[model samples]
Target: MGWLSTIIVGFIVGVLAKLLHPGNDKLGFIMTTLLGIAGAALAGFVGEALGWYAVGEAAGWIASTVFAIIILAVYTRVIRKR
Candidate 1:
């Protein structure tokens, strides 16, 4: 469930994140989805660890999307630096 949810949530979040945060992100489909997956997982674990969410509950959509945007920004920065 976790892995499948990650992929599904990743796709949804990826589209939303990209639309909300249009910048110098030269990401393709896979990379964008990867970004979303990373963001979703990050938010889920962090929110859980921070007590923002319960253990079994997935991160909220808004949280996932926002984190995805943050991840995208960080990604672009790293790419730019490299």
Candidate 2:
């Protein structure tokens, strides 16, 4: 159930994150999902560090999306090195 929830929430986060970011990301659906999942993890860490939320607490769509965008940006930069 945890993984399932992550994917579902991640998808929603990915969409919102993409919307939040300016300019097109040119990412496919699968990449978007990956980004969302990664974003959730990133957000979770940051949120925990900043005391925004509990370690296992769920991140709302907006927060998740913003985090996803940041993750996607970093991922893109790393991938471009290849």
Candidate 3:
């Protein structure tokens, strides 16, 4: 149940992040989902280190979405540079 919810949320977050990020980066749905999931995981670590949220606590929807977008942006930038 927990894993299911996480994947669903990550999918939604990934779609939202992809939409928010304006570019021509071609990525399939699966790739986008993976990116989103990775973004969420990264956000979790960042939030914990920055004291933005408690470790193991649920990240609010908006925060997670924004965090995912930030991650996506950085990812795209890095990919572009390479």
Q: How many backbone clashes does every candidate have?
A: 0, 0, 0
Model 3 residue runs over 4 Å out of place are: 45-59
In model 2, pairs of residues that clash are none
Give the worst 10-residue stretch by lDDT in candidate 3: 55-64
Higher-TM-score candidate among 1 and 3? Answer: 1
Q: How close is candidate 1 to the true structure, as a TM-score?
A: 0.81
When summed lDDT is taken over every stretch of 10 residues in candidate 2, the lowest stretch is 55-64
The residue-by-residue lDDT of candidate 3 on 1-82, one tens digit each, is 9888778878987898888889976878887888778777778777777888885566745566787788778877989999
User: Mind giving the per-residue lDDT tens digits that candidate 1 earns over 1-82?
Assistant: 9788778879889889999996768788888889888878788878877888775554467778899999998888888998
Q: Top TM-score: which candidate number?
A: 1
Residue 45, candidate 3: Cα error in Å is 4.3
Runs in model 1 with CA error above 4 Å?
55-59
